[model samples]
Target chain A: MPDNPQVVLKITDLVKSFDSTKVLKGINLTVGHREVTVIIGPSGCGKSTLLRCLNGLEPIDSGQIELNGQLITAPGTNWSAIRQKIGMVFQNYELFPHLNVIDNILLGPVKVQGRPRQEAIIDAQSWLDRVGLKDRALSFPRQLSGGQKQRVAIVRALCMSPQIMLFDEVTASLDPEMVREVLDVMLNLAKGGLTMLIVTHEMAFARAVADRIIFMDDGHIVETAQPEAFFNNPETERARRFLNIFQFQELERRRA
Target chain B: MFMKAAWLTVSLAFWGLILSLIIGFFCALVRFWRWPVVARLAGIYIELARNTPLMIQLFFLYYGLPRVGLLLEGRTCAIVGLAFLGGGYMAEAFRGGFSAISRSQIEAGLSIGLRRFQLLRYVIFPQAVAVALPAITATAIFLIKETSVFSIVALPDLMYVAKDLLKEGHNNESNLLLVLSYLLIILPVSLFFGRLEKRVRFAGFGD
Candidate 1:
């Protein structure tokens, strides 16, 4: 898979530790061009850590990460430039409260990337339109519902024209109904051939959207398979137990 | 003469506050960035400013410094003392505001490829200033009140005029006038800050 010409992101022997506690232990993963790889695991299992490491949010202890064939983990790497290529939507929306929906989206493009304001605004509007938030250009974050804020966050990332997008449980904070709207936007992105590395607890959404599924536990990649295969015929005992919790609860509900 | 004194008092307070804001913001940035050696120096300055009275600091600047041939004029000493005192409070206010910005916000800014300075400029500052506004306003009011002590340096301030009028044996009238002058200065300022705070809240900043 490393030799595949379509690979856009390559992580090799990736290790991360937090104050003497190892969070990621020598993990190797590859995500190809337009591939949607969804990482699923129980809480505290380094799923989020891996995404953080990829985005340069958290520093890696050892190993290397190559994005579009450039070694990103090397010292003196220009993260500001590299980060422009990697867009991330957070679980908490994290929209700038000071700016309106459109301003928030245009900030990175206009201010950071030094693009013209009018051009950036046009691009931002198109992104907002795609996410069904075109009318919310002037609305502030406090003025929007949780789902709308999350969608604005997605639009904010898209305006930068990132090569890859990272979704770190983007729908995790939304209300049940709100989750569907955010997930739908992501589903469209996945289907439209955006290279995405998603960490999610939405088992069904993960199965539906992921081209490949990665099951991680205790800082190790336990299993990697196609979504349907991983969901139906998990190889590891740990993954089986992990999936059974959701399945068993459904079974209990049916029996009742 | 009395009007001149009142103008001096307002002018001194205004300039002192401006100086303190610059000093405080710079020191807070140093401490926040944890720049070794210099951050320790900022910490020490904050402690010394916070612990000492403005009167003592003024006395040192006006009288004591002359002993070392580092003489400063009375008005200059008063302004320096006010800035020294006010800077510490402003720094703490700024630090509180900066900390209120969560890790995720910075991460979001970084993910958008913001440089560190850009992060501070775009994301961190606008919200932090909103959260720190009330405290900064309080500091401004306190700095204005501290202008009363500038009389000790014999710079013609509101309190200096009052004390001179007492020497002329017009006690109650002078005392009444002093109280009225302070009321005039403080009232409008308080009302203005209140309105500003409300506007920011209404505009939905700091949330």
Candidate 2:
């Protein structure tokens, strides 16, 4: 890691709960500019909840989240303004089915940001081309495959030019072959130095692209380390067990 | 006379539908916001309007309100009464539409920096309209039929004209014309809405 990379996102003792069940318990972390941080955890470990809290989609019970030194999670904060700096891609594509692909990409910039439609369309077209879906711009979401929908979703978020992007198991819902195409887009973004926080089960992709891997269990982060070290020599028993499950799956795949 | 009355009936149902849609939209928002007092109040309003008879509601508006120093013309009372009644059912249909939307869709809108109102207008409303279209069309058909109750208020609507014509000893012809007039007005309108419902059906995932 470069010395003293500028901190782009800061989280301090974040706590979130749904009624009596606590989901995130006092999480503390920071992401440097253009760094890729991947969060790996079992289901119901609050990984997705953490990403949701960053953008104020889920209100925090306590603690502060600062984006570019602006207090985002504070009461009376303008969440809409904060959201402009952050983008999120869900496990489900969540594309507006009524809209064609180009319209879906342009909706945020045109509707929310008040950009002129023609100008947004010009910009949105380039994003579509970048994802290799320029030909399908006028096609409705229902006309696309799972991979194509996820690609459009990523392009939609990118159209906002957000400073930080969050991916919540974005490929979890895709078919095995489709997952590769979606991961490729993320890989291309990582190479371009777009700051991202991802919650994913794809250990290999995490190892390949992550600057740091944060392992979460229950509601707490059990360990944070570089991907190479985390996979080869996990520090905590929880991390080891988590890796073993992946290792066993990998072994079964090889034998088959 | 019957032709004039049919036109009046159509006009009442049309205006009543517009008013009901507007009221139902806001009421659905109130429920969605989940504010304790207002949501409960909205809930009560829906229940009250839905459970009571439309004829009684019109009677209250036309006859009962004068006692409270709020008198409206018979025509206005019928329109308002039908609107109030239809709004209750429309609110439920809209609420169902709103609920059918996946939580992630709203989250996606929020994450993309859409303000609450913008999110509802652009992303949420379009998808919801698709989900709720059939219900709304059903409500429209019911409201059109419910306008017959306006005759009780002596609004000179189709049914009122039929009743007057029957009482004046023009019995068989008036009854046959009344039924045919209703079919003529309602069948086309219902068919139009049914086609519209099909047109707006969402083509997205999880439909």
Candidate 3:
């Protein structure tokens, strides 16, 4: 990596533990500008933990995490400076239930960026329209469907205009029928050249949109390849087994 | 005769309900924010007000706190007593609301770069209010009926006022006036809150 390369995020030897159990064991990852990296792993494999650490939602036991070449994982790192450039979307919608759709979208820009109210509102309305939720501007989170709530979450993050966006299984909590609509919005964002790091179980979508697909197990990167090479020719036995299990689960779900 | 007494019952309830709500909400906030020694002191006040009988609490405040150097009139003492008692319950109400909200909501706020104060104002507080609304409304009604305790304090509130008129005008005159006063005060209040509850439900205050 150069002193100031085009890479938007860099994680080197990131480690995290809880009591006696270690979750992320010396993982190295990097995300580049205008690129989408999808991480896939079985349950309890620390993929979500990695995503959480990137956003400072979970503290890393030891690691060096840098966003846009600025160190963010040190004990005395400037969080406000780093966080202002990153946006994250969680599995659950996590929308503020009390706020109307428009208020939820407008909150980040106005409060954090200290943008003038009128300017923030204009940006929020544009993002709301982008998510195809202009009509729901006055509606509350409870009034929307699971897919609608997730879309609102995306629009809310986009309202801040982050340089990097992180998605942690955003579709995991949605109804099966509702996943596609949410994914459609993500695909559009990716096409527009937004830099994103996604943790997803949807291999088909990952293959369709992700530039690089990384597979992990027990906190180590098992393999990193282009989506075609990783999905078609997994180099390791662990990757092969994990792919088989995911395929079997998808088959069972479809049959049922 | 029952109808006339019902009216008297209603009016006194109204005075109690409104006054307690104001007291309860602020006290709940004091407990929630954990203001240094104030939180523990609020806890002590709640225990004293709750463990003892309401009637006794009214008597103590109307007759007691004054001798200790705090002088308050009859009605003031009664209102203060109701507020003190209601505040204890309100603390629990607000705490329940606070715990009900998930951490993910706050995380979302932080992810968007909102500072601590901004997160609480824009996210946590609004959701907490929504979560606490049901318990708050129920407590409000409870406080209203509890106003009858003020009679023991000799406050000129609805119940005590009705009682005074009853004592002076004899059975026929006092009965009708008591009933009328209660019907005028309590019924309207209950009706108002009942409608508000439905609005909160229909408006979908809490998700």
Model 3 lDDT per residue over B27-146, tens place = 666676678888788778767766777788777777788789887876666566766777777766776777776888878888888777787777776667667777876776677667
Residue-wise C-alpha lDDT for candidate 1, range A1-256, written one tens digit per residue: 1223577999999999999999999899998998889999989999999999998999999999999999999999999999999999999999988888888898899988999999998888888889998898999899999999999998888889999999999988888889999999999998888889999988989999988999999999999999888998999999999999988877896999
Q: Show where candidate 1 strays beyond 4 Å.
A: A1-4, A251-256
Interface root mean square deviation for model 3, in Å? 2.1
Q: Whole-model Cα lDDT per candidate?
A: 0.90, 0.90, 0.79
Ranking the candidates on DockQ from highest down gives: 1, 2, 3
TM-score ranking from best to worst? 1, 2, 3
Badly placed stretches (over 4 Å) of model 3 are A1-4, A75-82, A253-256, B1-23, B26-45, B66-70, B205-207
- Cα lDDT of model 2 by residue, B1-207, tens digit: 878999999999999999999888888888987988998999999999899999999989988999999989998998899889999999999999899888878888888888988888988888788888889989988999999889888888899989988899999999999889988988998899877777776454445
Model 3: what TM-score? 0.85
lDDT of 2 by residue, A143-203 (tens): 8999999999999999999999999999999999999999999999999999999999999
| Candidate 3 CAPRI grade | acceptable
Q: Return the top candidate by DockQ.
A: 1
What clash count goes with each model?
0, 0, 4
Please provide TM-scores, in order, for all candidate models, with all chains considered together: 0.97, 0.95, 0.85
With candidate 3 superimposed using the best TM-score fit, by how many Å does residue B52's alpha carbon deviate from the native? 2.3
**Candidate No. with top TM-score:** 1
| Residue-by-residue lDDT tens digits, candidate 3, A1-256 | 1123488888999999988899999999988898889999888999999988987888889989988888888788666556778888999989887678888888877777888989888887887888888889999889999999999999888888889999999999999899999999999999998999999988899998888999999989889988899899899999999999989989998999
